[model samples]
Target: MSNETNAILNQVIVLLNRSLAAYLADAVPWMGRAGAEVGESLTAMVKDQQQSADRLAEFVLDNGGDVAAGEFPMSFTALHDLSIEFCLKKLLQTQQEAVQYLQQAVAALERAPLAKALVEETLGSARGHLETLNELLAAVH
Candidate 1:
């Protein structure tokens, strides 16, 4: 791959990692752990999402792309500090950010044949996260 392509992929990895950390931090203390069975399920969902993020990071690194280590979008912090109930809203916001990031990442990958497969694989999970978050939010609202 060209140097430009590699650099962009590295940036995308970093962005994904940042999004993952923010969302995971926001969703701590699952609803179940807070004495609500529903919270437990949410907690499980968070864990799964975390795993997916890890996998994406790993994939990026495997391709010689470093995960982006940076601050989440400014909007994530306050909600990250809130309780699980309030945090569910933050999770929805996070998924929205992930979708946006993934879209850009995929667009970048479109030029790098070597990096395309990894980004495509990650795209599937990112899209799934968006769908799941939307469904959960619908139920909550």
Candidate 2:
């Protein structure tokens, strides 16, 4: 992979760890009115993000690239007595952004066949997550 490709992939790792997955995980316990079932689903989404990052990181390492390790997104670190409606809204918004970012990453990774495939898979997952998040948001009262 070229330097540009490596950099983009690393950024994606950071996003998954610090933003997408971290946001959901942090908000799960505070899901006012969303209930245990939504929390469970959010937990699963967090795990999926981690697993996808692992796959990307492994590929990067095998190619002599450093994985981007980072803390949770700044927004996630802030305290808030978040409602289920607000949580779902934020999750859906971020999930939508992640999907767009992944689409760009997939396009950028064309020459890096393995990375492209991995990113494509991630993109697919993100799209699925986006749908679920939308449904969750719609159901919120």
Candidate 3:
């Protein structure tokens, strides 16, 4: 894999990790048993995101590059005051954005077939997350 491709994979990994961390931190306190199912679903999604990041990091190492972490500043104040419906909407939007990032990473990694495939798989997972969030959001109203 080329350095460019490695960098793209690393970028995607960092973004995934950052998003996962933010969601975990912000969503947990609000997720009592009433939100237990969704909380469990989010936990599973976090695990998947971590696994994806690990795979991307391994790819970067195998390709002779250091993985650079990506940072996203989280402002939970606005979200803190929101209702469950609003919070779910925000989460759904974030998942959609993650899917878009993974899609772009897949396109950029065309030369690295394995990397591309891994990213595509992660993209599918992100889409599934989006679907779940949509269903949850619909039930809110």
Candidate 4:
């Protein structure tokens, strides 16, 4: 892989990891209480996001790039005590940021076709999750 692609992948991995940490630290604990419809959707999103991150990591390894373990920022843990709606809103913002980040990555990777394709898939997933979160937030309100 090119240096540019590798660098973007690193950012994406970190972002995904942080999102996962936020979910596990804050969202998962309250998913059940979030409401029947929203809870079910959140559960599916959490699982899908995990699979997406794993696929990206495996892609990095298959391309001979080292896959670093992902870790969240320390302050994310401080958000654990917020309301379920607040947690979901925060996750939604994170997902939106990831989608935008991936968009730029895909654009930058145009010359690296394989990397671009992988990033596009992740972007699509992020968009889907973002839409779901919007609906969930509506339900919450």
Candidate 5:
């Protein structure tokens, strides 16, 4: 593979790591709470995001790149454990991070058609999750 290809793969892997970290960080307490279907849904969404990241890693390997290792560290490690209500708000922040990650994937894929197709597939799921979050937010408000 070319240096350019390697760089793009690295960037995509970093973004995938970021997405995984965001979900794991956000979902732990959110999913742990009772009476919070939204939180539960968020957990499921995060799981899907993790699978997407794994698929991307597979693509990276298929293209002759090394799969990135380790989980993303929590950026919100300072926050106290939150209630179901507040966790929804936290999830909104997480969803934003997810959006940014998907956008980065879209940008990275622009230079690699096969990667582009993979990212486009991921993008569809991201968009659906965004819509689900939007509906949840709207209902809560």
Candidate 6:
């Protein structure tokens, strides 16, 4: 993998980790029973993101690149002052941003079939998340 490819993979890993943490921190608290269900769904999504990160890390290692470690640098204000509709919209936006990043990573990994497939799979999952979020937002409105 080229340095550019490695950097892109690392950025995706960081973004995935950061987004997982952010969703857990910001979105989970406002949910009730529905929130619990959503939390469970988010947990599964986090696991998927982790698996993607692990695959990217493996690719970095195979290419003799150092895997990025430590915190992924997530920060978000709580949705305390916001309406449920607003919060859901913001969460949907975050999911869309993640999908965009994964798509970019997939495009960058065109030469690496396995890595590209892994990223594409994760991108598909993110799109599913966006669909669910859209449904939730519609319900809130």
Best by TM-score: 2
User: Model 6 — TM-score against the truth?
Assistant: 0.78
Stronger candidate by lDDT (5 vs 6): 6
Q: Which pairs clash in the backbone of model 5?
A: none
lDDT of 1 by residue, 10-95 (tens): 66555555663345545453443443543554555556555655765676667666565656666664554455656666666666
lDDT of 4 at 103: 94
Off-target runs (Cα >4 Å) in candidate 6 are 20-27, 70-75, 80-85
Worst 10 residues of 6 by lDDT: 72-81
Candidate 3 local distance difference test against the native:
0.76
What does candidate 1 score in Cα RMSD to the true structure?
3.8
Residue lDDT tens for model 3, 1-141 = 787887788778887788733555555546443476666666777887888889878878987889888766566455655456567777887788888888888888878898899889889988988898888777656
> Could you arrange the candidates by lDDT from highest to lowest?
2, 3, 4, 6, 5, 1
Candidate topping lDDT: 2
Any idea what lDDT model 4 has? Answer: 0.75
Off by over 4 Å in 5: 10-27, 30-36, 70-73
By summed lDDT, the worst window of 10 consecutive residues in model 5 runs over: 26-35
Clashing pairs in 4: none
Candidate 6 global CA lDDT score: 0.71
TM-score of predicted structure 2: 0.90
Task: Please provide, for model 4 over 1-141, each residue's C-alpha lDDT reduced to its tens digit, 9 standing for 90 to 100.
Answer: 876677787777767766843355443545445567766776787677778778888888888888766677666775666666877777788778888898998999889898788789989988998998888888878
How high is the CA lDDT of each candidate model? Answer: 0.60, 0.79, 0.76, 0.75, 0.64, 0.71
Residue lDDT tens for model 2, 1-141: 678888989888887887644665665536666677677778888888889989999988988888879777667645245665666777788888999999999998878888899989998988988888877777765
Pairing residues by index, what is the TM-score of model 3?
0.85
Candidate 6 per-residue C-alpha lDDT over 1-141 given as tens digits, one digit per residue, 9 for 90 to 100: 777777777787777777743455444455643666556666776787788788879878988887776463334545544444556677788888888878878888889786688778778878887888788767655
Number of colliding residue pairs in each model:
6, 0, 0, 0, 0, 0
On lDDT, the stronger of 1 and 5 is: 5
Position 60, candidate 5: lDDT? 73
